[model samples]
Target: MTGDIFSENHEVEYYETNLLGNMTLSMLTDVIIMISQDQATALGVGTQYVIEHGVTWVVAQTDMDITRLPRVHEKVQVQTRGSSYTKYFAYREFWVRDMDGNELVHVGSLWVMMDIQSRKMVKLDEAMVIPYHCDRVRRIQRLNKIPKIHDEHDIMQTEYHVRFTDIDWNSHVNNAKYIGWMVDVLPYDFLASHVPTEVSIKYEDEVTYGDPVLSRGKFINTDNQIQTVHDISVNGSTKSIAEVKWKKLDKKGSK
Candidate 1:
């Protein structure tokens, strides 16, 4: 979906896929962001332009619907549009389609403008608002929902040593990469057996480069399947918190 105000396109890559040769949820999240940045660039209000004025956009939530997974060597078309703007937030939608126009994935996201110095979310400045030129952007009602925490301590836990590549423009670890780790540690057969139908994550805190983080995975049983839930925290420090939910099919220990 492109209006004159925004336009961008992306090509899929082989390394972006998993061992199964299909695009992964984590990679889709990155592609969604790149399209958003490209949209801003077309309008001359890109990240450099926004950052020059001491403000940056941070993704608050993303809801993704997957129809079919694009495989390796298949170059998909990724397009993005600035759907709307609110007081201090902007809503954007993205689509990934095959060359024949068959839709493969749909994504909608909410982003907040923030002050660069304070690192806190802030209202949209007048300059930031004037470019998009929309008085009101449609409100996205079904935002990606974060999983609820029932018992904070009883989750599957592991620790990760942060690497150099984890940081993105926002300066903390890129939110999507954590999801990659979640997929990596799960039983290989489980990943092979169940395709992820839905994923929702909450970014409660930021994990900086070089910070050690502890990741915990948990699950709830319902009607013979398990909803994989994960919470990540910086080791020895309560500084950062994050969570992810994986909708899994098939038995836990079965192939």
Candidate 2:
């Protein structure tokens, strides 16, 4: 398992669907992270393994391009492979495809090993790098930088209480939950008329239990696409930011 790619199939549960009956972006992200973890576990470098080594894997940045959204009850296949690594960062690629083998989504992510107690990034040792059998290639290149969303007059803002379920095994809010929070603040009419074609997120800090998070977003309409930039903050400090680009769908379902 150390040097091999891994894949898994999943049924899009009803709970994972949105009002449109298609898998929500956040839930789809959850599935991608879950499968990545499963593959890491099989390769012997997952949560427990990293924790035992006094560090944990944390996502630094992620970019996903979705061509089609899986519908509820649809069985989808997810495949992942470790692609490359440096002293402090590792890259991985993931794909989600429908039963007909048409790719629905492609994702590229950057991860860092962080010391649990100090919460500082640690350099990857041979032990950590060897097992991944990185191919030294990337399906989608790592994002150089995600632009910060500045405060503006028309930006929408909302406050949310961190719930227990939002926390993951690491005792912090899972990254995908941030996407959900961002979407929750979008105008209902916009959501009803458009569908996201791409999403990129950069995790700057962790949000923990008892932390009150504020979500702010700015929507932009271009000639061909609608874009939104979101920032999640705590105690007036920014924690994470995400950007989503959407394409309008007509009443007849044409993009």
Candidate 3:
């Protein structure tokens, strides 16, 4: 199992695209998680395997950098590898590329195993450790700590009720769903005019079914880039924080 880099091919489906006809950031994250699960299953440590052991993998943080997003019907390849692990954290790296072998996005994530009943982090076992074949070298810098959003800034907020579709087999809202919720709060005009270049998200707590979540966002403009910060909260308690950097695209649709 050592030295294995798992890969999968995908075609951007119509349903996965945004109004701009490009792949949505949330869907991209979903694809990354799907391919990672596929690889884990092949190595005998997937969702089912972990559930049987009363533990499941939970993402603590993720950072993604995008060069371009694929359009609907475009074929892409996703490759992922287990990069390393510590007493409580496991690191993973993912790359998405077009058929021409040009990279579309790069992602790095930190994960932890949690006991189902206790809902607390647990040390990874041999089953989880041996199959990953960790290299102990990071391909991307680890996710940076997202700063808390202060109230002094002009923050826009939206409320969303957790729907059934948002819940995964783990009986909680999927991590990627938070990204989608964050995107929904941005002004449509801004979304249509700019594309995200870098994204960082840190998960602090879990939002379960039937929970009402609030998404708050603030934007900062620099000469070359626009940065946005988002905080997702449940019952006034912050659950996750995310930051995105955007580069304005020319009218010709070039960055």
Choose the strongest candidate by TM-score: 3
**TM-score, per-candidate, Cα-based:** 0.83, 0.92, 0.94
Please identify model 3 stretches exceeding 4 Å from their true place. Answer: 1-3, 136-141, 221-223, 252-255
How does each model score on lDDT?
Answer: 0.68, 0.83, 0.86
Residues 206-239, candidate 2: write the lDDT tens digits.
Answer: 9999999999999865676788889999998989
lDDT of 1 by residue, 165-207 (tens): 7887566888777777665556777677666655665555577
Of the candidates shown, which would achieve the greatest lDDT relative to the real structure?
A: 3
Clashing pairs in 1: 156-217
Question: How far is 94's C-alpha from truth in model 2 (Å)?
Answer: 0.8
lDDT of 2: 0.83
lDDT of 3 by residue, 1-255 (tens): 134789989999999987777899889989999999999999988889888999988988999989988888989999998878767778888999998889999998998899999999998775676777774443434577776676646888899999999998778998889999997899988888788889999998999998999999988655776889999999889999999998776863443
lDDT for model 3, on a 0 to 1 scale? 0.86
Q: Which residue runs does candidate 2 get wrong by more than 4 Å?
A: 1-3, 136-140, 252-255
Using lDDT, rank the candidates from best to worst: 3, 2, 1
Full ranking by TM-score: 3, 2, 1
